[model samples]
Target: MNPILEIQQLTHTYSAGTPFQRTAVEGVDLSVMPGECVGIIGHTGSGKSTLIQHFNGLLKPTSGHVLVDGRDIWAKGSDIRAVRFRVGLVFQYPEYQLFEETVAQDIAFGPKNMGLAADEVARRVRDASAVVGLDESLLSQSPFALSGGQKRRAAIAGVMAMEPDVLVLDEPSAGLDPRGRQEMMAMLGRYRQQRGATVILVSHSMEEIAANVDRVIVMNQSKVFMDGAPREVFSHVAELEAVGLDVPQSARIAALLRDRGLAVGEDVYTVAALARRLLALKGGGGVC
Candidate 1:
């Protein structure tokens, strides 16, 4: 299968030709296939945000290229604005960017920018609002009147209204309570399933990545430190820790149990999987 998004040795240097010039991302290469959900995790200032900005032409590469569907997005005369509609990006604290007077207007902003018809924009607003769990009653209210979580939902609905083939979220669940985080992720999952969209999630939470993504990409020092399935990547707990990254809690606990002479596997990164492993060690006895 063809990759929906591809990065070829991409590099981005900030403030080029100045004394403060520094490379945020250097010689990084990666790909995302259609309908796949991938997570990117890194320490602060590890270039995760810089790297993703290239996906939708938000930041032009200093060298190399970013390709969307076999075509370089930076090719001469290519329409960069069209790429933004194909790859929807929701930044951290996106609620701060919501400026429309009404929730519905905010959600319709992207679709309207794409020059969609009135009927089509209205349909997108309704569909995106429902996907994000926004109520019709709130459509007429100002975005600032909503709670933090509701504002976030409205902001995300704005991007979803564009019906992008690839949705990229950076720290999407930041600052939310556990329930709110779960609800937000559930909404994204539903959106991906319904649209068959490829999802790229950039987060610092190992548990969130382990539970939701098909693949994980660990970044360090402006490079791809590790890239693999969650189980595959988490199995290298020592390497991850060496680079100041955390593994999931279940994986850490399983490692501790194994150190104490238990037979738990290093690949146990989920709560249910760890529980089952312990149960099997107890000869399949039921736990109260």
Candidate 2:
């Protein structure tokens, strides 16, 4: 299968030709396949945010190409606006970007901008709201009146309404209560399952990534450090820790158990999975 999004030797530098010149992303290459879920983990300055901004042309590459469906987004006469619509980006604190008078108006903004008719736009707003777990009654109220979590969901609904082929979210669960964060992840899972769209998430939480993503990409020193399945990437505890990144808690605990001869495999990255392995070991009277 072809990649829905591709980054080739991508680089982005801030304040070029000035005293403050610095490259946030340097010589990075990546590909995101259709209907796949990817998680990226990095420290504060690992260039994760800068790299994702190029996915939808929010920022142009300084020296490389970003392609969507085999077409260069930066090519002459390329429809960047179309790219934005296809690869919808929900930035961090997207709620702060909402300015429409009502929730429904805010959610309808993207599809309406896409030139869809009123009926289709309304349908999208309805469906998107339902997907994000927003109440139909709240649609009539002002966005500013909603709670933080509600506003977050409404803002996400706006982007989801566009029905993008690829969904790129930065910290979709940031600053939410545990229940709210769980609901947000559940919403994303349902959206991907229902639409078969490629989803890319940049998150700080290793546990969330371990449980949710099919592929994990670890960034370090403004470059791609590791890329693999969650279990594979997190298994490199020493390398990840060397770069000031932490493996998932379950993986760390599993590693500790393995050191004492529990025979717990490296595939364990979740508490439930680790517990099952331990239970099976005890059941069969394997060396603990």
Candidate 3:
């Protein structure tokens, strides 16, 4: 299958040719397949945010190209706005962007802008609200009146209302409580399942990536550092650490056990997998 999104030798330089100029991303090549959940992980200033902005033409590349379904998004006469509609981006702390008088109105903004009929927009609003677990009764309430978590959901529903083919969320669970974070991730999972959309999650948490993504892309010093499945990426714990990124706790524990002579696989990054391995060892009288 063709990739839903592709980046080729992409580079973005801020304030080009000026003393304040800096390259946020350089020579980055990546691709996202249809219906795949990919995670982008890196420390602050590692260019994760800059990289994702180029996905939907939110930022024009200083060089190279971004392609959506094999067509260069920046090609002459190409409609970048159309690309944006196909690749919905939910920014970090998205709740802060909510401004409509009512929750439903906020969620309807995207669809309405698409020239959709009012009824269709309303239907999308309802569907998106349900997908994000927003209460019907709250649709009429002011967005500011909702609690933090509800506001976040409403904001996300706004993007989901567009029903993009690819959803790009930057720190979707950032600043939420543990339960809130879990629910947010679960909601995203359900959205992907229901829509069969490609998901690109940008986050700082290895645990989040380990638990949610099908593949991982690690960025360091404004370039692609590693790209692989979770097990493959997290197995190189030392290399990840050297780039100021942490592996999941379970993977770290597995590494510690291996150092102490326990026969555990280095790729065990999830809690469930780690627990199963320990139980198997205990059953074999290797360790309890």
Predicted structure with the largest lDDT when compared to the true one: 2
Candidate 3 — what's its lDDT?
A: 0.94
> Against the true structure, what is each candidate's TM-score?
0.97, 0.98, 0.98
Number of clashing pairs per prediction, in order: 0, 0, 0
Instruction: Give the Å error, residue 164, model 2.
Output: 0.6
Q: Tell me the tens digit of each residue's lDDT in model 3 across 15-131.
A: 998999999999999888999999999989999999999999999999999999999998999998889899999999999999999999999999988889999999999999999
Q: Taking the tens digit of each residue's C-alpha lDDT, what string does model 2 give over 1-288? A: 999999999999999999999999999999999999999999998999999999999999999999999999999999999999999999999999999999999999999999999999999999999999999999999999999999999999999999998999999999998888889899999899889998999999998999899999999988999999998998999999999999999999999988898888999998789989989999999886
Please report how far candidate 3 places residue 51 from its true position, in Å: 0.7
After TM-score superposition, the amount by which residue 31's alpha carbon in candidate 3 deviates from its true location, in angstroms, is 1.2
The weakest ten consecutive residues by lDDT in model 2 span: 176-185
The C-alpha lDDT values of all candidates are 0.94, 0.94, 0.94
